[model samples]
Target: MTIMCSAESPNQPEIIIAVLAILLTLVFFLIYKRGKSTRRSILLTGICDSGKTLIFSQLVHKKYVQTYTSIKDNVGGFLIDNVFLKVVDIPGHERLRYKFFDEHKSAARGIVFVVDSLTFQQDLKDVAEYLYNILSDDVLAKNKTKFLILCNKQDQTLAKGSNAIKSILEKELNTLRVTKSRQVESVDPKTSKTSVLGEHGRDFSFQNFSLNIEFAESFGNHNKDGTNDIDQLVKWLLKIA
Candidate 1:
C-alpha cells in the first residue's frame, strides 16, 4: 500500500511556505548588507602647512584641530552623524612631493583642498599647479569628484579673501585643462579637436566643462582662533551626505 501526494498538504504546505519566506528575507538582508558596506572615500589634497591635517582632525571631531603635526598619506576614520567617514590626508610638504602627490594616484569620491590663506605665498601657486595636473588626469577628471577648498587661517593677519582663493584655484584648474589640451593636440589631433574633456570632455559640444567649486569657506588659525570657523566645513561635509 502507498500513500498518494497532493499539490497542497495540511502541514507540509505550510512548512514549505514558511521556509520560502525565510529564504526571501535572507536574500533581501544580504543585498542591504552589501550596499551598507560600500564605503565613500574623500581625498584631502593640498600644499604643506595648508592645514590638511587640521582640517581632517576638525572634520573627525566636528570642531577644530589646533595641534596635530602634519599627516602623510595616511588613512583615518572619523564618525560623523553616526556613519564612519574615511579621510585620506595626503602630505603637502615640498620634500614629500614625489611620494604623495606624484607617484600615488588614489581614487577619491571628493577632494578637500586645504589652503593656508594667511601664510600662503606666491610659491604655493606652483604646488597647486602640480596638484591640478595630478588630479585632472583624463581618468580622474571624468569622476564626479567634488572639491572643497578650505581657505584656512582666516583669523590670521594675512588671510586672503574668499574671492582671491577662488581666483587662484580656478586659474590653476583652467591652466591644467589648457595644458592637457595642448598635449593631446600634439599627440592625437582628433582627441584635441573633436575630443571633449574636463567639464568640457566629449560630454558636450557647445559649452565648455567647468570645475564646480562646490564650497569655499574659512577656518580660524589654531594660535589665535579656535574650531569655531570649522562649523562651515562641517555643514558642507554634511550637505554631501
Candidate 2:
C-alpha cells in the first residue's frame, strides 16, 4: 500500500496572480482596440455652402468639385496616413443635418464643423447655436467624440483665420451656455444642472470639454499659392483617425 502527496510550490500563489494580471491586461487592450475600431464615422456638419461637400469630394473623389446642397448624407471613405477614414458628410441643411447626425451618431469617432470663415461674423449666432447643440448632446458627450472647427474657405481675401474664428466661437459659446442654462431652468429646474456647459461661474472655453476640440484653416478650392485646400483638413482627419 502506498499513499503519496506532492506539496504545492512556494511561488504557486504568485504565479497565479501574475497569470491573472496578464489576462486582465490583455482583455482591457482588446476592449480598447474594439472600441476604436467600431467608432469610425467622422461626421461633417455645418450650415449650407460651408464647403462640406467639396471637402467630401476632395477626399473621396480626389477632386475639388463644387457641389450643390445635398439633401442626404454623402457617405464616403478616404485613406490618409495609412488609415482608412469613414467620413460621413452630413447635409449641412438645418433640417437634414440633425436627422442624419442622429442616425450615424453611434459610429461617430469625430466631427468636423465646416464654417465659411468669411461669413462667420454674420452667421456667428447660427453657428454658435448649432455647435452648442452638438456640445450639449448626451450621445456626443457619452461617445466622447472629438471636434474640429474647420475654418474653411480661408483662402479668400475676406476669410478669417483659424485663430480669430476660435476666439469668436469661444465667446459665442460662452453666451450660449448662459442662454441654454436659463432655457433649461425655465423648462425643467431639475434638469437645468445637467444642461449647463463648461464651468458654472466661468466663461466657456473649448478646454473645458474632456473631449478634444480643435480648429484648423482649410478650403475646398485652389488658393493663391495653390495649396490651401484640404491639406490641413486631411492632416486633422488623419490625426483623429
lDDT of each: 0.63, 0.85
lDDT of 1 by residue, 134-235 (tens): 555554455445557777778777788767766665566566567668988999888875442345543321124454455466665464354447777766
What does the lDDT read for residue 6 in candidate 2?
Answer: 94
Q: TM-score of predicted model 2?
A: 0.88
Of the candidates shown, which would achieve the greatest TM-score relative to the real structure? 2
The candidate that wins on lDDT is 2
Off by over 4 Å in 1: 1-37, 61-71, 94-107, 119-121, 138-143, 194-212, 224-228
Clashing pairs in 2: none
How far out, in Å, is residue 137 in model 2? 2.1
